[model samples]
Target: MNDLEEVAGLLAKPEPSEEVVARSRSRLQHRALGHGARGHRTLGHRMRSPGRVRWFVPGVALVAAGAAAAVVIATGAVTNAGAPAPVSGKEVLLMAAVSAERTPQSSGTYWHVTATWLDSEIPPMESWTSRDGKRWTRNEPGDTSDTVVPASISLRLKGADVSFDDLEKLPTDPEALKAWIVQRKGNPDDMSTSEIQGDPTLTLLTLITELPTPADVRSAAFRALAATPGVENTGAVEGGQALRMPDPDGLGEEIKMVVDPETARVVRANLLLTADGSSGSSDGDIAVTTDWTDELPATPKDRP
Candidate 1:
């Protein structure tokens, strides 16, 4: 059978054992509670060796699997649906900017983000991060254990260590925000790189996924992206429209973001290889879900 058939076959298999399901759910719940200010003591119990398994919220995992299957089927039918009218990259970004600006301001004690990282060789890895940048929980599908880390950390933004307060304090004006990013980089030329992996445009793109960033700041970042040169609309991928920009590092890998126009949020981001036979060319993709809530999980079942 071909690759698509193989994927379909795998997804058609029966559900996991109830014991496995229960354990995974319990672990996730425990991790959620560990994000609380008083839950640090429970951190040691969750840490375990990383195993090759697909770890994600069970419900979300099923849905994502279904979605992946649909993508495989839809890819075969995309060409039959006559070509869609081209949309400008700037227009898309501007639309996203407007939507972002309209989002209500919210603050929370813990900023929660659930993300799935995909690669060819490894099973999709799911991770959750807490607000204080102190707790991170990760699991892989089929793995019975969750790896939890509790340490003071900062969200890496535009190559800088940005705390939650820093995110909130970012300038909301597009020009001012761009200037700030430039200043952070030390030199304007530093924003562009021929060998390094990051640049100003890439930094802004990354910022959009960071949930703790204020809505207006995100809006400004989108506006700055709209004004950036080299960004081009890449039509649609898996139902969402995509924008592509050449990697400034000259690595022949394009940064592609599948954007949800109505929400003005990126649904997925990918680093796709453009050059033939590039060694060590492992591509990566991320699917993100953000929750803005002040509630923390209750005390875990096994507290240290």
Candidate 2:
């Protein structure tokens, strides 16, 4: 089996979250009840996921998976016996950028993304966007039917709305890309009391994983993330390495991502509430899959 396939199996174990955060099912249950009473909804459904952690929408949820016990990492590029060398967190991001740069340009009739919330109470969401971002097909959560609508659902980077053409023209150099992100993020100083501060890490992660940017642009994003402060490779885990970043919101939460370096794919990303971070019980999380596909589901007969 390939490396990512092997990592997927390792991820099936139930160890990572234990070391990360003690899950409080009771708190989740209580919050869920509160959501129901308040008529909270996931997009259009009545089931709520988690509050916006300043990085995502209220209905979006992060991904989750199991992790193994932390182990000593490799100190160099390779061992004397030729065994694979363990890499640092920064190294992992750099390597992922290389891999992303080597990816061939591709296209299909539709751009697909599947975002599965870690919370079991919420249903997964599937969406397909037309190449020009003028049409969309979405499988609504808790609804068996799928519908194609004449609506625009563009990919968002930071707070800027971008189309496929716009993504294609993004700067591929790390410095230029960083500047672009900062510009799109807007100035937080001008915001009122309700606006949340921007998290550059989250925006970079979204660019690399979710946006359909060119391979070189994606590589630049990875390189930018490697240089970001507080982004650390924690240690070895079962499926892959675990990388942690300080919670930008200062809400007593830490951001953790399990990534398979081989395929440059982020297996899961979660927000763990540290013991001293916050009294809140919700875990703001997001796991997403984005790709190009040719298959198009049927649309309503009456609507074009």
Candidate 3:
């Protein structure tokens, strides 16, 4: 089982009530993600392990974030009053939340994803899952044939195993969304990637990246991340803004994501070390593409 699948197994317990989750949120807000926060592995770290390699279900292009950032900057029209107001990282996230709320919803037969590693030999991958999240298929690197994914499998979101429908049904209000994720995430001790388990920032980022998530729910996730303490707007990169979250563990590793403020889409996500000045390469960096489509690829049985 992949890390997500392994984590999904631990969620058999009943979901916590709203009241219970609310209390949990209060504690989560106060506690930073690092500082002994368990299971805090990078996305690439988990994806590269011997047997666990899968494109992040709802991933995005690595350079897209940079290009999107450039767009955000190029269109910075000065206000009638003065220079465009300085925006905080929190403000940027909040703005993304608003944009997400305004996004129109879409549906189709399959939730499709394609991804490639930034600077590695990992082959590009394509995946398709039924809208309901029951059936799945994948095109492996260099393989002419399609592989059927087990119907029993599902992606992880906010610490729970969820179908596309479940994603659509997630709470739209920020506080409620936070409560819901924390409740499902349960204890960090049982999770494989400790980086996200107790960390509200990473949890919400994961929600934003997942496919088939309702627009408003994605907005809620952004708002929750913006509300978290210690998030910073580290200035403009290319055309987009860089929003950096706190590093509680003092591991010297920093996590930053680029967002296309215009569309409320996260263009890039990176896990970097403070001393690693070189941006030209990182094994864990990847480009992810996600969408919905009705045309499914023919399986081997349908092929000649």
Candidate 4:
């Protein structure tokens, strides 16, 4: 089996309200919820799934039976590996420490950030942070956190602090994944690759397929963590050397993420509904190639 076929196994693995639910479930039809044909021009905003009732994501591959198990992860790169595996009592202390360090007495962790994508028409470069999932702060920080600057958008996950495998374990819609599933032109069902290069390690997944759409990319990534095995933040699946699982419904797409294991932070990701059966690459005007290679910006002011 291919590497992803391998990762698919152990690696585990939303949407919105009703008016939102209608928006969330529209992935299959690839239509718009409240917008028109012109409004739906970009798949990023319109493609949302309705399964999780909290978010939407990308494509998936039902894993083949007993494909392969046992995956060896690189060191100090898979989440808290630098320290001894926590039991229960100590775990609490570690978590509390992590939280206190990032959270100020009455303020948040605000990091100056600059984001971009292949779509040059991106919003703008500005400051954005969220203290609790509900409120958003823009450019200038103040006492309150219920504002937006349009020019900037912060990266925050609303539901739970889910991991990669979480995507597969969660029940999310399938439509959104399609938009991010890229397999070259005319080779829809073909496979791709995801290469991760981080400090002290370099991990690569072959036949890399599946990703989350822009609309709900954040939640979709957590779903992926749900299913990851042999790793922390592995939502539903257990940890191990390697794992291979079946998609059943391509639910694997939900858990799409490329994170900095040590920092427990995200570096990059692609969520789109796809697998070994679809074809054609979404490129040109409708398609995009967003390349993200940036140092982890300072911790966001409002971190979880």
Best by lDDT: 2
> If scored against the real structure, what TM-score would every candidate get?
0.59, 0.63, 0.62, 0.25
The C-alpha stretches of model 4 lying farther than 4 A from their native spots are 1-48, 51-115, 118-127, 130-254, 272-304
lDDT at 173, model 2: 78
Model number with the top TM-score: 2
- Ordered from best to worst lDDT, the candidate numbers read 2, 3, 1, 4
* lDDT (C-alpha) at residue 132 in model 3: 53
Candidate 2, residues 1-304: lDDT per residue as tens digits? 4232222222333333321111222232233233223211233222111223232245443221100011223322334575433445665665566667777878898877665556545455566777766545453322344555433334444434567888888888777776666566432332211123434565566676656778888877777777766666766865666787766556445667766655566756663211111111125444556788997666676546
Backbone clashes for every candidate come to 7, 8, 14, 70
Give lDDT tens digits, candidate 4, residues 66-127: 00012222211122343322111111112222322232222233323322222434232223
Give the per-residue lDDT of model 3 (tens digit) for 232-254: 76667643566666544344445
Residue pairs in candidate 1 whose N, alpha carbon or C atoms collide under 3 angstroms: 53-140, 53-141, 54-140, 54-141, 55-140, 55-141, 111-131
lDDT of 4 at 216: 29
Task: Give the Cα error of residue 60 in candidate 4, in Å.
Answer: 17
Residues forming the 10-long window of minimal summed lDDT in candidate 4: 195-204
Give every collision pair in model 2: 16-67, 61-285, 61-286, 62-285, 62-286, 63-286, 63-287, 252-277
lDDT of 2: 0.51
lDDT of each candidate versus the true structure: 0.48, 0.51, 0.49, 0.23
